[model samples]
Target: MDHVRNANPFTSQSSYSRGSVLAWRIVTPVSWLILVITSIYYSATKPHEGKYSRHTIWGQNSHRHTPFALNSVIASLYWIALYILQVPYLSSLFKEDNTLPLTLASHFTAHNLLTFGFIHLWCRSYFWWALLLVIINWFNLTFAYFRYPKTPRVTHVAIIAGPLAWAFVSLYWDGAAAVHSHHTAARIVANVFLWTWLVYGAFYIVAFKDWAMGFALSILAAALGVGQFFTAIIALQWIFAFTIMAVLFVASLPVAAPGVFGGDVFKRGEVVSEDRERAPLLAEP
Candidate 1:
């Protein structure tokens, strides 16, 4: 009983590990903040509803000012990439002594591969890119369940990086006129992607030992999940708004819980591993 009961939720560790997590998490709220501030400014200062008003309908295409849009891009990327890139930080949580971030060099270029947006110029407007994102989302969900074999770590990057990069490209390609013409069709797929990101991304964070980060994340999710409704991004109306608000709020509340991969990590409120070895701790039991 004691052996099974010994898992500590806040298992103390070297400053480096804790710092890595903290440093990375700092971007979470900041990115959200930038989004919030920019969203408000973007909406408030928007050109009075004339020709541009059509584009204003969808939050995706609303921001036109290059500087504002670019700033939003930077903050948004930092917010998301911090957590997604934590594939290394995540590996270290179950292992010890070794640098979780370092394991990438052994495989392929995880960091560079994450910059999938650069390809937008070449891969413009093809249905295949969207299809590829679908594959990547599945890989992320599968990896979240599996968590080892480490190959999925790169795919995890694809989870967000792929969609986000596409968002940038698609919105650019769609332009103001196309946005009005295809808002419904676009939202159909975009909503699916939104929920998918929320799902896998939430699961990834919950898999960690950081309860505080999870809770903070939840608060952000709730506010933004609800806020998205006001932005008119998803045309499904109140049901969609209420559902998203409820789900996002819930995601951050529990770090580890029963039925999460049928594991006791959360129900026990434990860290699950403290195996301070130099090599990455590939074994999880």
Candidate 2:
């Protein structure tokens, strides 16, 4: 009873092995650095031709000519923001007495490796394979999201929810490319899939109280709307995208904003400081 009462949720380290902590401390940064270098390399070396070119989307040809595609510039900016958030999250894992849970470490490693594979496959015009990678990444990130600690909200966004949002959006973008079918049935299915963003955003917000995921989806929806609008001025896809964006943006406020609805959403309330004169700690069993 005393041990249970004295346990600190934020700082408990006994469950982790030293080797797991050490390995991830070295592996995580190296994997992230590799991804950065390769992304830059692919973006620079791949030449822009046209829709049929191997470097169709990432080169000077920024437009993807698809309803579900996000504006390339906006997508790039989102990735940049995600990467910047990752720096602090990765650094936090290296703090003294911080033990990396095996489950999180495994998912993190797989997500990074699959992401590395995805960039290469995507640049090579292997849309089907890239879509496969994104699917795996989506499931892996979802598991990581639930497994991860919720406090210190920035890291939660950085490590799990943000990447999950990207994966969720990429499913449509990559799936469209993989199919590349102009049949009315296929087009109808694609249009229907767009609404899943709204469904997913709503589910996360209500079920998990995860405003970060909802916000990420909202921003991505806006980007998709921008792309769809420029692709076809008369189409309703852009209108649908924008509507989803508005709905998610509004719905997410309760869990994120502070007042009657939200209270210290980002504050690490579990981490009690010593100045508060906590009860004396008991040795772990």
Candidate 3:
């Protein structure tokens, strides 16, 4: 695990120990608790905006609905496809079969290449985007907090911290496995992390309004386009597939928001504030 920490800024901290690990596990649930409480508070007191409610494929608004319905549908489909693709590989591994070494190598190689390429091409972009989103969302949530200070603060905290906590857990687990040269463990952990991200991406697409989603999607598409171009240079189809997957993940983040394919017309929340306003009214006669 020291090797894993070699590149981390937190290397000076004590190595993760059984107690610290246990503490993290114990505290992780607090985020969930906050999520529940905040959800309830928001549900009870927040003004319901029926026009912005979830819409059906036919474009009819479904009142009193959460974006989770659509998110669940898409996530379920993705999960099924993922399981179908992975089960055979896992079964083979358990049976001590190595017949698919090339396939496995190709899969992992593509992932590694794509990850590194993306980091090289878009890590700074993603960092800025993520940073901006974090700041904006924090500001918006702060407004919500001040406006309704009595509302359980847990939910807002959970919403922001949940993904981060999971990311750390995933990194720690994967890092430990890699440190021990447990390739199988690392692969499994990585797959689990990917699946979690896939679901989160789905939720983002289904839950956010249009402008936010569109901005994210555009950035993602551009990144993938660049990543795929590099993959072409390397002559690896798997890298292209991985890049597409990454794009899909990015597109999903803002689907749940207001607009989407329609662009500015569907923008919502503070995004509208950040955006330039439409042209001023013409001088009246």
* Structural RMSD, model 1: 12.7
The TM-score obtained by model 1 is 0.38
User: What is the alpha-carbon lDDT for the whole of candidate 1?
Assistant: 0.37
Global lDDT of each candidate: 0.37, 0.72, 0.31
Query: Model 2 over residues 150-202: C-alpha lDDT tens digits?
Result: 43566667778888998999888877777773456765776788899999999
Model 1, residue 122: distance off in Å is 8.5
Model 3 C-alpha lDDT per residue in residues 92-142, reported as the tens digit of each score: 322222222211222222322332332221212232333333334334433
Off by over 4 Å in 3: 1-181, 210-246, 249-260, 263-265, 275-285
lDDT of 3: 0.31
RMSD values for the candidates in order, in angstroms, are 12.7, 5.8, 25.7
Which is the winner by lDDT between candidate 1 and candidate 2?
Answer: 2
lDDT of 1 by residue, 156-210 (tens): 3432333333333233223322333345565464445445434544554556433
Report lDDT (Cα) of residue 233, candidate 3: 41
Q: Give every collision pair in model 1.
A: 256-266
